[model samples]
Target: MGNKNTIIWIIVVVIIIILGVVVVGNRKAQAPANVQNQTQEESTAEEESLPNNEVLPIGNNQSEGSANTDTQVSSTAIVTYTDEGFSPSTLEIKLGDSVMFVNESSGGMWVASGPHPTHTLLPSFDQKKTVQTGGTYTYTFTQAGEWPFHNHVKSSEFGKVIVK
Candidate 1:
């Protein structure tokens, strides 16, 4: 029992350290090359000029000269589905933005406002539509709240989108 407890403590500490390193590394990697060497005021100005509340694409996706990604940065926001579940299990978006549910797995998926079968959490948001692999479903979020959703096909996999 004591050995098991010691092992658990060691595992927890290692996980925390790894998470910290990943977070720090991501911050550095996400910053634009032009802004990395700039003064604080310059960085502040750059941020102020960007579109607010929408998640900014990292790296060259933000560059005016780069347009190689299959998905373009448009008014549409994406929530991708995988074999396990949603790629971004939690998302934040501006009110009135469209949320695109892309089914990337071999299995079809159902996205509905939840409490499982009832889906009464946001009744009007309910739908029987199922998107197959490589297919998509989009819903415009006009209401401001944290909307909980799940894959009806795989009920246990769920996520929420907070609209500001």
Candidate 2:
């Protein structure tokens, strides 16, 4: 009888431990919900702030506005994303000018200014913000340099925006 009681007690302890682990795991998963909500809110606000959103064509690799060699900055530029990759693979924008990276791809695209995996070239310009088909992500250039960027999912496809 004593041995049987000891075995039953051990089984009960194991079950309690398992239940504790499952509860903790669930809490960990829910923790990110709050953070995700905040990020979505911020992104929505940024999109709302921009004006005159021009819808560029899919696979259109043309600069939305004419490249200005002089100091005059183009008001806004749209770079479309398709299976071929970012349109206008190379773009030139003036300081304080905004570039809208619009995704018209079938799946999500991760756009980040980079030197490959680490997007440290222009840290402020990097975003893991996944743009679903028809979604847009915009960034204003504050620094003057050639900022190379790539689709984090498809690294082979790359592009750069030259800020002058």
Candidate 3:
């Protein structure tokens, strides 16, 4: 009878330990769910506080007076170089626009410039396209600012893109 009682007590202790482990695990799992719920509630509250009628302007050549007009203009421009550098060293485009560079030189030599070296376009902009003689390269601008770029091959030959 004594041995039987000891075994029963041991079984009960084991069961209690298993139950405690399960409870702790359940609480740990529920903690992430609680955090997710709180995050979702905060996100919903933030969205509700934002203005509902806010709209972004689209198209090109947007001036103060032409803000309400629906006349859509092409925000893209083309810059071609045949002899030395870009035809228009100083270019003007909309805030969100793109420029295509066409290499018309005969030899395998082409480059462009901005506020800095054009080779830095890698890891920032699309520089995969190399302007090899007849090759063409295109770059798009999404941010608003004055960017000066220059060709790594020829630092003297540079250009500037004014984003308005």
**Candidate 3 local Cα displacement, residue 159, angstroms:** 0.5
Summarize candidate 1's per-residue lDDT along 1-164 as a digit string, tens digits: 99999999999999999999999888877675446657567767668756442335544455533543222332568999999799798999877777888999789888889999889988766547787899887888888999999988888888898988
Local accuracy of candidate 2 as per-residue lDDT tens digits, 1-164: 99999999999998899988898877877777767878888787667654324233321323433333233464788999898999999999888888898888897888888987888898878667777898888888989999999988788888999988
Clash count for candidate 2 is: 0
Error of 2 at 72 (Å): 9.2
The TM-score values for the models, in the order shown, are 0.53, 0.54, 0.47
- Go through the candidates in order and give each one's C-alpha lDDT: 0.80, 0.81, 0.65
Candidate 3 is scored at a TM of 0.47
Of models 1 and 2, which has the larger lDDT? 2
lDDT of 1 at 27: 81
Error of 2 at 71 (Å): 7.4
